[model samples]
Target: GAGVSQSPSNKVTEKGKDVELRCDPISGHTALYWYRQSLGQGLEFLIYFQGNSAPDKSGLPSDRFSAERTGGSVSTLTIQRTQQEDSAVYLCASSPQPGTGNYEQYFGPGTRLTVT
Candidate 1:
């Protein structure tokens, strides 16, 4: 009965370092999503996974960002060679269904990453 959750509520790293952020979605949810929120900006869509379908990774800013969902439950977002522009709150969400219709998604508190 657990909801979507993210680890290391706050992360501090130097530029060029790599960081992996973790997310645990609710049990039985078929859809998972990753988003980023920059300072004073709205949530920016990232990667999305639905069941066994190919993930929609068009939202990833660059090759430095990648994510994976294993066994359709847990997900991890890896940011290679972290940059100051990467500093923001990383959010994870899950929904019972897929697509951009009217499904509702449960969101995690988000991991705040700071590149110093």
Candidate 2:
């Protein structure tokens, strides 16, 4: 009955510091995806996972960004070194079939990260 959840609706950190954002998807959903939107920018895919399949992390901005989904449920996005350019809203979504096509995703409110 629980829906997707993300920690620290807002986060502020200094440049070069590391930050970790968390997401908890809904029960029974097999697919999870992470996306990001920069200031006044559109959404960009970060990583996605479905069941036991491999995750797609092609949209990670740089080597400093990484993520993992465990138990096919909880996911964490880690920023090795924060940057002003890294400041954005990190969003997570889940669906019945993430690796499959045509299903709409349910999104979390998102974690807003700010770097100075």
User: lDDT for each of the candidates?
Assistant: 0.96, 0.90
For each candidate in turn, the TM-score is 0.95, 0.93
Q: Could you give candidate 2's per-residue lDDT for residues 1-116 as a string of tens digits? A: 77789998999999999999999998889989999999899999999888898988888889999988888889999999788999999999989864457698889999999999
lDDT of 2 at 11: 97
Deviation from native of the Cα of residue 80 in model 1, angstroms: 0.1
Candidate 2: Cα lDDT at 82: 89
Top of the candidates by lDDT: 1
The parts of candidate 1 lying over 4 Å away from their true place are 99-102
In candidate 1, what are the lDDT values of residues 1-116, reduced to their tens digit? 78889998999999999999999998988999999999999999999999999999999999999999999899999999999999999999999865558599899999999999
* TM-score, cand. 1: 0.95
Q: For model 2, name the residue pairs that clash.
A: none
